[model samples]
Target: MPTNGSQAGSKKEFQYRTQFPPDFDDEGESSGYVGFEHIVGTLIWASSQASLNLFEASNTVEAVTLERHFTVNSAPDNWQPPVDIWAQISFSWPVENSTLSLYGDEALCDLYHSETTHCRHQPLTANIVTELEIVYMFSERLVSHLDSDEGIEKTAR
Candidate 1:
């Protein structure tokens, strides 16, 4: 189960170990190489916001399927137990003779760039909800808005 704010090891230091290919260079490839720390941090922050109540009640979406399939714990009334939230990561690999192409890279870059450019708050807005949260109107007919702009904005339909 995932948690919001202080719980769910959000304050804990994140550590990861990487194993490179057998022919990969060690020292030369190590320094001056930047990793996806910000992206990973953003994802972890986003998971904390993926509340079932927010998804089901506030967003007006049927989440029974998500609850049934992904939830390992079902004690919603009890705040003692954190509600289960799932974050799925799918990777694309090159086929036998083909090369791998990451088309999503451009999309991610665009999103991050938009967040930086358009969002009023710089980095904190990436994690916590503020007035800077970018809101997208999917359809003019679908005119449901939260009474308060306290929760994270839904960027997609």
Candidate 2:
């Protein structure tokens, strides 16, 4: 383990663990972590930490209300349209002169090439991206939340 700053000539150090602040995600199972300490060798699996970092950075209040509405079918080949988990993240925000709808072209791609044909890999990707989109929507809202002065805060309530 190494410290970011040198405290002594002997190199006093500490190992840092990634922590997602409470200001964003809360009360969600598997919030952004997939608990994959055993997954090894695969490129994305090896880069799990970086993937988690990207997910944490997208923490917007929009995340808490994100609803996972999707359909998945794995009866046949795993490479095609309408991925096993075709997810939709529903969110509305007042930005600039209009509202925003986040899920438009985030359709899933091939799982065969990625070696994600296994239920574990495919489901994790779908779930993670769905959540990631929710987080990104919040970052996007910042631009519009500042510009909107009048409108309706309509939702699926």
Q: Which candidate gets the maximum lDDT versus the true structure?
A: 1
The alpha-carbon RMSD values of the candidates against the true structure, listed in the order shown, are 20.3, 22.5
Q: lDDT (CA) for every model shown?
A: 0.26, 0.25
Candidate 2 lDDT, 17-110, residue by residue in tens? 2243332233232212221111111212323433321111111333454422221112123335423322222322222101111211112322
**In model 2, which runs have C-alpha deviations exceeding 4 angstroms?**
1-6, 9-43, 46-77, 87-157
TM-scores for every predicted model:
0.17, 0.14
- Clash number by candidate, in order: 0, 2
The candidate that achieves the highest TM-score relative to the unseen native structure = 1
Model 2 Cα shift for residue 141 (angstroms): 28
